[model samples]
Target: MPRIGVYNGFDPVDVCSYCIEVLKVTAMGRASLRAMPLTHLKAYLSAYGLRGPSHAVEKEDYVRAVLDARQSNGCLPRVNEDYYRRHSIPQPTGERPKGFLARMAESFSDFVDSLPQPDLSSHAPPPPPLPPRQTAPRPPPRTTANRPPPSMPPRPQATPGPSNSRPAPQPTQSNPPRQSNPPPPPPSTQRPTPQPLPIDNLLTMKPEELSALSIGVLKAILQHHHVRIPQDALEKRDLVDRVATLVEAARAEKEREARARAAEEEAELEAQRQALEEIERKKKAAAQKDDTGASEGQASQEEIPVAVPKAAAHAAAKLERDGLCVICQDEDANIAIVDCGHLCLCLGCSELVMQSSKECPLCRTRIVTSQRLLRIFKT
Candidate 1:
């Protein structure tokens, strides 16, 4: 069957087919394996009872896996010379074969072989044999006659002094034992100096932490941060206290600044709110004023009293005339004597009339008591 993964339009299939057809196998016989599509290689692997190339990312990996399986298990089918001969079909020789260069090479070789050959035995004589190598005679052994004299003369030994005259042997002196410089003052019990703390950390250090530092370290820190150190701060505790006080003051100042900023922001917000309220109140008042002005204009236009007809005017006049006291018309006749029921006296006139005489004007009856009139009107 045609290669299983062949697809006419797909780029991967096209590429794989191109590789397999155009590329020659490498010396290691892995070019075909590497060129084959991943799917085709994976399919071949299944027949050999090997795992697919699912784990193999690169072409080399696939090639390696295939090579390992093929060599080790010999599971993949192979075609030998006999297999090819058995399967090969003979084609009819209609015209001459296509290999013109092979035909030409064969003809040239036959022509060369058919030509006369040169005989070297009769043409040239053999070269003369080389003479036997002569060995040189040996030289005589080195003797005293051949030896040369020394370059310098040897010196003579000094004569020994008389045995009694020899100087007495000097006494052998013994060296006194060395005093090994007292064991280096027992390495004074000094601890390693600590590295200086960072300025930021020093600024934030607590009282206890400050107390742990040496007075010199504390002073150095204060100098680095440009803090004014008190002259009396000689002791370690005093330095620690000074540092602590500075830290607290800095923290408090920071907090105060933050609070002040927050208060300023709040004040700004409150002012904005009040301004908005004032704007709204002004809008409402202006609206109400507009409404009031409209109402006043309408009132000015419509509030004129309608002229009364003569009859209504006469009736109103008669009513008013009747309401006044007959004695003195200055005040309204709001009081009436009870027994007589005469409505003629004003409140002031009623008192005077009661004091003068307990009598009604029209009936002339004695007035037992008086009551004020309250008029009622229904629209």
Candidate 2:
């Protein structure tokens, strides 16, 4: 077949590398198991299959989760053979592995053992105690004391010593400022008002969930919180629709920002890609560039000599000799290179890879997202 030359914007494989780098796995969290090589992860998965080694997988995931968090920024390294060898630990096979691979596995295991485990504290609340039995009220105490009685006076003949001076000026108390004895409210001063807690509104919340939601989230929650509304309550429908629309728009905006961030990181990492070195190797490419073109009275804009196809091929062969993939292998099965040549599988494997790693799988060259994905086959 004739050698097909494609000059496009970016390579898919390189893009994938960007993605991988952004998605760093090392920081993904080391299992509490310790600094285990990443290889044992495969073994762990293999051993458990369906019902998992909860502890092991959890440990791995914990670390991977951390890495995943950073992947969005393309700051993570690619998961390649080296990565697997460097990070993975082998599980204990009943009969130990023999030879170099076996020894390597053992070493990896040591690394895992070196990882720290999360402390599993028993902080869960104890079960509720049985209700106390009702008790009868106690009677007042009867004190025993000898007492003297009777000093009786003769009954006073009706009414004299009358209204002695207006009943001794009716005794009065300067009532201390009427004590404001209001009941103390519950501990949390931030309890939602009962008005906002209509049966309908409360229902939408998670069962017994006190969502500390923002105003926008709150409005969205309201739409679904209430149970049933009357047919004629068009206002409810309108409000719900409005809130839903607003929420969707906000979520979309957030996602766009996240992707943009990832893209930026991918670009930075790509700028450091090694593939550009091919440009330095080619004399023809160098000759194509007119260093004095600027002073030569620029006819139209002068174009610089980019790396040539032959040089790129030689770079690829060299990288292969060093055991590197021709293109940056993003996590995806496929990869892509742009303009200078090639594409991975049909899907935008390059883009996906870019999201994960910074290095190309094939040439192990550093790459950027600005490189175009020219649809051409890799030799």
| Predicted model with the maximum lDDT | 1
Tens-digit lDDT track of model 2 for 114-167 = 999776556444444554454556889876787577589878666667543223
Mark the 10 consecutive residues where model 1 has the least summed lDDT: 370-379
Error of 2 at 294 (Å): 24
- Name the lDDT value of residue 308 in candidate 1: 42
**lDDT per residue, candidate 1, 96-182, as tens digits?**
443322333455578799998887777455554554554556888766675576678856447655752545545444555566886
* Full-model lDDT for every candidate: 0.54, 0.43
In candidate 2 the C-alpha lDDT for residue 328 amounts to 44
Poorly placed runs, candidate 2 (over 4 Å): 1-234, 274-379
Model 1 Cα shift for residue 122 (angstroms): 99
